[model samples]
Target: MSPKKRFEFAFPDIGEGLAEGKVLELKVQPGQRVKQGQTLAIVETDKVVADIPSPRDGTLVSFGVKEGEIIEVGRTLAVLELEEPDSGGGEAGMEEERSLVGNLETATSAELPPSREGREAAPAGPPVTAGTTAPGLGQPVAASPVARKLAARQGIDLAAVHGTGPGGRVLRKDIAETAENGRPPAAGRVQPLSTLRRALASNMERSNAIPSAVIHELVPVEELVALRRALNEGRGGEGQVPRLSYLPFFLKFAGLALREYPLLNAAYHPQRQEVEQFGEVNLGVAVDTEEGLAVPVIRRADGLSLPQLQAEVDRLAAAARGRTLRLEELRGGTFTLTNYGAFAGLYARPLILPPQVAILGLGRIHEQPVARGGAWAAVPHLPLSLVFDHRVLDGVYAARFLRRFMDLAARPQELLLL
Candidate 1:
């Protein structure tokens, strides 16, 4: 018998620290011929549902994980048998090159590499720097640069002109307005927000309108950090050594606390005129992406172990950044968490997603002086912000939930019990 050649496919980092995900559906079966970048399966992460694509073109042998099963980041998702595995390898090379573009720009900037005599080296190219005002400065701008130039040739000022572009940015309509008025004033053009920006704007507006009362507390995270380091050391593989994050610990504690204080996990139902408490804890992990903010839910979080949680996070994050997430992956979140601390923010008042009564905001870890055995010492601490629906939960309940979470986070060992 001829020996079978085996090639392994591991999950790639899509972005947003998604560690693991639940396999929702498989598009290809074993022994099937598949092309590179072909959709293989649909995996749902905490923030979104993404289609897992084939890493290479080959004949599928078998799946490393099964449908409805959870998968970790960097774990083999599938195996393939290839006739010529290295064929069309240039595409992968291009992807690697694109990834380094940002670093190249940073390293090649004029400030980084000064010109001869250091006369503030000229720009690399055209005047594309943000906030540059060389154009239309000291001139009555009547429309877009092109429109303004056209109007100027015909002696038109855009100031007295009415705008037709969205948000009243000077457009062809403004020139028509100038002609109707027999005069044009200096008008300038404005750029409209992109689709992603518009989506974010709407979400922010909706979040602001929800009646929310925020409760804040401080949690000593010294033990949590220690646990993460221990896990990393014990795993001992390139990707097997999990990237330690405070999120898994937080999710564990939140799950236990939810059982004790169901009000935190309950959603307010306006149509039914009742409070609906969920039997399962589907926690949403907020992932910020180039497209916008996405929250993928980890279903039945209360039932998963710490290792399981970590793996799922890894997979989900990778899928999110890849933009292969599916629509179904974003549904059914009972509670939401926004870890703003990852970006160095002290704390943020995250708006609560509707129906879900509460949302948790995690802030940066800060070092503060503490008295240890009568001696002053510095300790790392995390700030916790909980915003809840004031109508459903009172201050006392909210405070108790925050206190429990803080206590559990301070002593992370207790979380393993639940």
Candidate 2:
């Protein structure tokens, strides 16, 4: 029998350009015997909350990261002690790695040397916590656990203080001195962006790269409003039929318009100089939640009946707000629709998401005075903002799409209802 080896499970690249995830929970602790495929920890990534599972059966030795710490891709997450077979077993059945999201790469005692001090060796590289960066350096700072705890308890950023201990590791005295020195107020200190904020910044930066154009229009929706109210009043109790919102009506209308003007429901591959258009309108509806803006896609938006559309919209909105939406629900959107009217915005200059050529923004519906048959009448008009990528289509094409959408919205009765 071979000596027991230590297995190091590093964080995996779970696709969708995930850089890091914040550990929401630790499911296992040292000395706990875990079976293969057991969940080790739960983490919050850019898109969803995920579980980091054990790749192979072993005894949990130590964790490279603690709960509430952020683990970057390629950094070790946990260490496990394993008994290896002498022959016919490839790296003690721990060579390959797998996770709930995707494949992962792991290292073991075969590649890494074990600690000579009679304890499990920690995974390579430091866990990149919230404030592990050095003052002027981008790398993680070397500090004792005691100092780290004291600094955190005192609300002192380790990166802003100079170390005085051996090997320049920040000590307890350094933290005490920094707190006693009275650093600048929180308003003036450097505030590192959270994981969600970082993802939003990256997306916004990419959005700014597209050559976008926005055109606004006001469409009368008195008839649509009356229809929605009647439908809502006639609906059954909870779990039978969902309450209707104007956004669902617009979602259906937008699908029809996208079918008529397929160019608007297309993706532009700039590197390949190609435009990929889809027959189905996979509409992405933007839902604002406490975490941030989440766009959940409704597959085949053009085919659903009014009730189905409303129910789906309600379900997706609820899931997004609760942060329980599946990965597939947040992907493969050919076009996006965002309703900012809930916030009382009349018209907004919404930005276009990358790859998708167009996005439709809906604004608050309000009464506008109009002249009808030599008489002044008030009509409810819904504001619309259509933003599109110039590289995929021009202003005229986008305007025509919006016109077709408004034509559908003009008569909501034409759409089939359950």
lDDT of 1 by residue, 151-258 (tens): 656666555555443223355556665777677444555534432354456667867877789988787788888887887775746656566567887888898888
Question: Candidate 2: how many backbone clashes?
Answer: 0
Q: In every candidate, how many clashes are there?
A: 34, 0
- For model 2, residues 70-113, the per-residue Cα lDDT tens digits are 88987788888877653455564545432321345233211111
Candidate 2 Cα deviation (angstroms), residue 47: 2.2
> Residue 412: error of model 1 in Å?
0.9
Residue 252: error of model 1 in Å? 1.0
Per-model RMSD to reference: 19.0, 9.3
Please state the error at residue 80 of candidate 2 in Å. Answer: 3.1
Q: How does residue 10 of candidate 1 score in lDDT?
A: 68
